[model samples]
Target: MERISKTITAYDKHCDVYNDKFKEFEPYVQKIKEFIELLEPGMKVLDLGCGPGNVSRQLMLSGKEFSIEGIDLSEEMVKLARKNVPSGKFSCRDLRDISFPAESFDAILLSFCIVHLDGTEMADLLKKVAKYLKQERRLYLSFMEGKKDGFEKTSFSEEELFFYYHSLEKVQDILKDNHLSINKLTKQGYLESDGSITTDVFIFASKGN
Candidate 1:
């Protein structure tokens, strides 16, 4: 819990820096567009760990009218998200406490934030996400790929942030357990702010009716 708190604090303290670094970056634009293509116009979408609303902004920029609601653990990030994506609703909320109604969202975006959750917490969160997603809807997830979890410092902040790296097989099993069928899974190299390269795992899954 302490590590999580510290990670949130770091984000709160460096929200501006993080936003500046990522706001215009669109390395995953193609993947996001593919996910968007699966949905119809005027659909309800939820963005967890929305981080200054970058992904939400991309969704909006796709020229589709989506009712987007976004949440982040950092109040500062929520504030920025509201400003950046004024058409969308933004809130400060922990991922572990998400409590939206079952089958409420047409699509859910969880970008790279699952890196903070361990296996058990990740499973619980995926279950909740699956419940909130309407049947036949999509869920997008991205995370740093690895076999271990720990705290690490990034260029954005001096404070060390907790990171959880789940292997592809582990994530696959968890998605299966939650009844989310994988539609697409890909790995791409991402250059970190600290000048290190990390493998990023992206997954697009759909729920069965």
Candidate 2:
């Protein structure tokens, strides 16, 4: 897990830069707002892979009156997130290894995250997360779609500390095998640095219904 450790360390050292470059905060907030509109008040929410807590802060501000927890592997990101959303709890930890009782959360937010894991690990993580979700609880996940790389083949640098381009069919099968039912799969063209566009997919899942 050296790459994972290095990626977390790089984010810890450059939280601000990562946050700025991603520009995911806006869409992240908007997505949570959309989800909150569908949720009942007083629900418990988990922001998985919540980098810097931008989406968590927005969830707090959306007037849902719900309990929320944000988690990330990068301590620096968690520290920045705590500063942003003082009312909520933020922890530095891996999503695959999150520990919570079964049926603990009403919803889990996974925005622009989860694509980092290899297929096997992703499937295992989904099963683990399913244990923590209450009945009808939602799992919102987003990914930049393309291709897959073996865990050993993936690498990252200080400036580019994450990899994407995952197959949609593989992701769907993984979730399906884990008992998380996908309600929707939205695909769009994501513009790259060289002005090229690639397809991206976002999925909304719920406990087996």
Candidate 3:
């Protein structure tokens, strides 16, 4: 497998404060809950790019029983995930390179992740995800939605990590191509640090034949 991408490695330099900055993001709560409510308890779940494990924490907010494991390119993020959501397992590995048995997970949560990947990477990621997910099993994604795909530099960080935006139509087509059926696609707006409102797309899909 290839080495981690430059943008992901850049995140490690700021891992010390990653949790302090993102652990408070609560917008994913309702969306995650909506997905969980449809499933039975005790299903194993994977939290891909689970920075600080905020999504894992949100999934557990309802006292629901589920097995969770998270992977991130930044080792520091894994460390914080362990501290933030002790009950869930955390690993420092790139999601693109990780392997799992077929149908290993009942559901997968990808919160505020995948925005860094363009169409090709996203397609590859979803195909790998399908291998580990059972037929009809769910996949949740949250990303910065844009009308077109491109890179944007950070406004507050010293490091020049580029954020990639993939259009909603392109993403949905990728999912379909990877044999995943879309269940829901919704958008939520939140105020950025500059007090400007930005919309994020949340998608729930099921693995298909």
Candidate 4:
């Protein structure tokens, strides 16, 4: 996980600039509205890898009154998350270190974060998320699709950052292995901070439902 450590450090260094560059954070807003609309208020939702609290802010403004807590590997990013959405709690923590009790959360959101984890890590993390979610809870994942699994250099940042990519089939296998059944799949073009575009795959899953 040395590369993971390096990525975390790189994010900490560029947290502020990254936040500024991340101008359009509404790509998943409509899908998120639809997902949360099926649930009741006061349900706890964990925003996995919630950079700068972008998703958290949008969710709060959706009028759902969801109790959201965001966690990231970068301390500076968590700081910015707290500043960006004061209503949500933000913490700097690795996904692998999660130890929340079973059924502790009603939903989990992973956006632009799964690329940081490889196949094995993704499987393990999904298993944990499945355990934390209630019997019929949901999971939302938004990632950049890839023809193959690999890494690419940064477009805007000069910090030598690299982002991993995953194919839709690979992600589906991982979810199935972890006992999370995909309920919806949406594909669309997503613009990054540097104006480059990539295919975005949004997957909504439930407890093997």
Best candidate (score: TM-score): 1
Give the whole-model CA lDDT for all candidates, comma-separated: 0.88, 0.75, 0.77, 0.80
Provide backbone clash counts, one per model: 0, 1, 0, 0
63-123 per-residue lDDT for model 4 (tens digits): 7788999999888889989988888989988887888999898889998887888767777
Ranking by lDDT: 1, 4, 3, 2
A best-first ranking of the candidates according to their TM-score comes to 1, 4, 2, 3
How do the residues 123-204 of candidate 1 rate in per-residue lDDT, one tens digit apiece? 8999899999999999999888854578888877888898988888888898898889999988988887777788988899
Candidate 3 local lDDT, 1-209, one digit each (tens): 22235566667777665566666646666777788886678889999999878888876665777899999877877888898888999998866678999999999888876876656777788788878899888898888865344433343345646566777788888788778888888998867666677788998899883
Q: For every candidate structure, what is the RMSD over all alpha carbons to the true structure, in angstroms?
A: 1.5, 3.1, 2.8, 2.3
State candidate 2's TM-score: 0.87
Clashing residue pairs in candidate 1, if any?
Answer: none
Deviation in Å, model 2, residue 148 alpha carbon: 5.2
Tens-place lDDT per residue, model 2, 145-178, is 7644423221122344555556778878877887
Clashing pairs in 2: 147-165
Whole-model lDDT, model 2: 0.75
Candidate that beats the other on lDDT, 3 or 4, i.e. the better one:
4
C-alpha lDDT of residue 37 in model 3 = 83
